[model samples]
Target: MYSRRDERNRHGRDLTFSLLTPEDAFELLAFETAERAWFEQHIEARKEQFYSSHGVSQHIIDCLALNAQGRMSPLLIRHKGVLIGRANLRDIDGENASIGYRLAACACGQGIAQKALKHLMKEARCMYGLETLTAVVSVENQASRRVLEKAGFDAVDKLPDHARVADRRLDCLVYRCVLRQEVECA
Candidate 1:
């Protein structure tokens, strides 16, 4: 779990990050339902069942199982005790992991994404002992690309015709951030 007071918002509420639990199924459902259109614009399409309660419950179960095996960290972002978004560190391979995040449609304009990402990066290094983190964003997603850059990530490469978005193929930009660098000794 990670907690930090954020002063960026007018409410001045502390932001809390925690592992996704079964208890959050309903809140997750609501968040997904509300942000479905907004998210689908930038992310891959979700199954029809994923919008249902049963599917969400199963997702929660799967996330918990992955957490148990230490292969992923599925996190829920909260502000003032309300579920506002999600951030995940997945595909863990010794000191490296892929990072991903999404915010509620209403939560977009603010600096919340950048703040949450910065905090996650810190936790990834200190708590999880991670040395490097990576993210891939669609070339058309300028906002997301900016978020990654503001969070100290550098665009290392671009893959043409990388992914299929809806009916057409789109390019993807790969960004990476090294949290800690090892020093060479004499």
Candidate 2:
């Protein structure tokens, strides 16, 4: 039921969630390059080579491979024909997966991440047959924590000194959400 660039979920009307594809390499590269510092503030930084065309292509290929094997789900976020961010479901084991997202600086504080995340939760329940979704956020990232809270994730645990950001070690919080899909009658 998902299309190339028109996938819409119930969270909001302005955001589009589409499966990641090889065709998005360059645009994805630009978005990532522009938001590199912003992203590294809260999460791990990508290697320098990952900013290049070949690196992105290889990354897409590798992600698609995992998608084909039912091990990962990578999504691209768009707003009115512009690439804005990426939301991903990785480490997918039966009934469980880890979720993460990065938003462009311009897109942050605009409720786009919350909507994208809720849309991702729906995809997890309906498309991937996943029951539990977990997210890890750095303690200093209050915006992301608020977004997750608004999207129905509850703080479950904290990992001490689990992440390093801006040359300093920081604690990370683990958030979890359970989905209850409705059963359809035959």
Candidate 3:
């Protein structure tokens, strides 16, 4: 039931999501090493930054472990052969998809998120037959909110007291983008 055209149509244009493989460990490890050091010196001293505050948990380790086992696909963001960040197209729902990303602090403000998000969105529509994409962003994280907004996601609601950044409660913003609408507009 699948032909070359079908596969192409299902997976979308030439824009492919470069999958993360164990082979990527070297580059990922390098980025993480550099980031952890940078965080300790700069961002960590200030009220605990995003990646620094939570760091990586056993849950993430387990998830990556499962992903390495081929249970999921994680798209990596690489520039000039360097691992800059990663995003996962988790929880695909027939016509909708949810994704999460973590970028190297050094890669911030470089529009990497935008490029990654846009690529995923396009892939979701063309390949996954998805109509919408969603993401939950911490309200205090204005940079991420801006990135989503720049990618045409609309903040639909304010989830109050939904997250705890330490002892203080933090709100979360629910952002969504209609993939079909974007494609049609494009």
Query: Candidate 2: where are CA atoms >4 Å away?
Result: 1-11, 182-186
In terms of lDDT, the poorest run of 10 residues in model 1 is: 3-12
Ranking by TM-score: 2, 1, 3
The digit string of per-residue lDDT tens for model 1 on 1-186 reads 333333365433467888999999999999899888888777876788989999999999998898888778999988888888999988878799899999887777677888778767876786678888999989998988999998789999999988776756889999999985432211
lDDT of 1: 0.83
Best by lDDT: 2
Pairs that collide in candidate 3 are: 10-127
Tens digit of per-residue lDDT, candidate 2, span 1-186: 665334433224766888889999989888898899988877888888999999999999999999999989999998877888999999899899999999888877667888778777887888888999999999889999998898779999999999878778999999999876762212
> Least lDDT summed over 10 consecutive residues: which range in candidate 2?
3-12
Superposed model 3: Cα runs more than 4 Å off: 1-17, 36-72, 166-168, 181-186
lDDT of 1 at 131: 88
Model 1 misplacement above 4 A:
1-12, 181-186
Clash count per candidate: 0, 0, 1
Ranking by lDDT: 2, 1, 3
- TM-score of candidate 1 on Cα atoms, chains taken together: 0.87
lDDT of 3 by residue, 123-160 (tens): 77776778888888778788878889988899998888
Q: How close is candidate 2 to the true structure, as a TM-score?
A: 0.89
For every candidate in turn, the CA RMSD to the true structure comes to 5.4, 5.6, 9.8
TM-score of each: 0.87, 0.89, 0.67
